[model samples]
Target: MEGIVGYGAYIPRNRIKVEEIAKVWGADAPSYKRGLMLEEKSVPSPDQDTITMSVEAAKNALKRCLINPKDIGAVYIGSESHPYAVKPSGTVLAEALGATPEVHTADFEFACKAGTEGMYVALNLVKTGDIKYGLAVGADTSQGAPGDALEYSAAAGAAAFIFGRENIIANALESYSYMTDTPDFWRREYQYYPQHGGRFTGDPAYFKHVMGAAKGIMDKAGMKPSDFNYVTFHQPNGKFPFRVGKMLGFEKKQIEAGWLVNKLGNTYSGSSPLGLTAILDVSKPGDMILIVSYGSGAGSDAFIFEVTKRIEKVRDLAPKTRDLLDNNRRYLEYGEYAKFRQKIKKAS
Candidate 1:
């Protein structure tokens, strides 16, 4: 079974508190703080974007594995915020990682679940023996309208996973997906920010698909919530994963290790994968983990993995998700954030 050989995550150092964004919009800070349970989210620098972050994360993933760059047969970059519409982000990432000239590359977009989608393809490719290894990344400089609810949560981050059979770290066990054309969230061509149905994103879209996938995988694997050591869900906000976990019979303590949304905000495609990286960083051999991701176009992907002894040897090879989540953070004021995110209008 081809499984995870190495995994790495990159979270931007800059942060903007929910209060800061709330204040800018003349909304009640306490409301969002209490409701979303989010303190701050990540922000990218002017020079940083999806491609750059993906490259950084790929480098980090490579550091944890023994495979030479040229041996990588595929690289898939999944993001809603790919820098250019026409150019393929995977090619740029492959070139930067020295995996180009002999790689199958594609950029995937399925809202937030795009990363896991890439992971599914990469894993299957390796599973079929067509590729020795594959690099799948979920990275995004997530965006929101100036005063939209998403502004308080959309943030930047990236997670890269190296999939191969050799020296497996977290052995992949089972996978499943649930999807529908719910149209709960979308951004059209030339539209800067996405439009989402407010309460609609919750009950019918995110929750429905997330629950379906979780139950589907557990049933297929003949496992229960208590069967796993840790469970991670797409964290669009700090509260969703916890709420969904409880609803799905997972205890808070069982899910807390991967609950990074409060600290780093929602990394869109990077959200669940980033949380999984954090879990792998601290998990011991034989630990079982269940990860599920939700993308608002209305879908979820679930995977069950068992951590291997190899994790102990390579977990420290690159920066752990916690260290990145906790260290070198610089808070951004509304004005500075406006400039950094290019939200300010320039006088001609």
Candidate 2:
């Protein structure tokens, strides 16, 4: 059967507390905690970018699978913040991963959901026998306006999944999607930060698309929210995903199982995939997992998966999101954060 054979994740080694950001801007606590629900956010170093993070994630995934790079037939990289505008990040990743010249590689972008979108595409390719193994990666180092609310929450991470027909750990059962031409949030070509419609984004864009897709998949599979052992959503912040969970009748236990945003902030394209890696780390053999990913322009992709017995053997090879957060970190002040994010350059 065609399914996910392995998974991996990468979180940077730096963190900035939301309270620190609030102090820097002289903003009240309510805005940072209540509005964003983020206490700390991960910050990548100057040496790391989307491509580097993706490579690390992909490496971990390959290690777990023990598959030769030559066996990977295609590589797909999903990111809105790719290091280079003209070159294909996937191709660069393929080279870094030591995948042979025969592989097909490309990059994808669809706001934040691009990585999930790449997962869907990779699954289809593997199912059709177009590839024996495929890699799908989601990574980003998102930017927000200096001193803006988004600055405190925007972060970086990467997750990679290797899909194949052998040793399947989670089989894809059903999938559903919802799309709309809503401009809930967006950054123009020349813009550094995104423009959002605020309340409109919450009500019609995120809620509508995520709910529509989740419900659609559940309905198609003849299952209810309680049937799944875990549910992970694309976390733009800590609040939005939890709100959607409540609306969809998912319990706190289910939502908390993937509480990535609380500790790591929003990794943009990497958010949902990183959550999936966490789920796989603690999930049992027979557990059912439901995942939803959302992007601006607004769209959502929902997927249903069932864990296999093989998971117990491979689980240890994958990095737990908690460990990734707790063990690896370098604290940064507001000034350092600005320099890492390139808001300021030193005098020549």
Best by lDDT: 1
**Global Cα lDDT for candidate 1:** 0.93
Q: What is the C-alpha RMSD of each candidate to the true structure, in Å?
A: 0.8, 1.3
Write down the TM-score for model 1: 0.99
Please name the candidate that would achieve the greatest TM-score relative to the true structure.
Answer: 1
lDDT of 2 by residue, 92-207 (tens): 89999989599989898989998998898888899899899989999999887877777888899999999999999999888778999999888888677788787787888988
**Reference-based lDDT, each prediction:** 0.93, 0.89
- Deviation of model 1 at 195, angstroms: 0.3
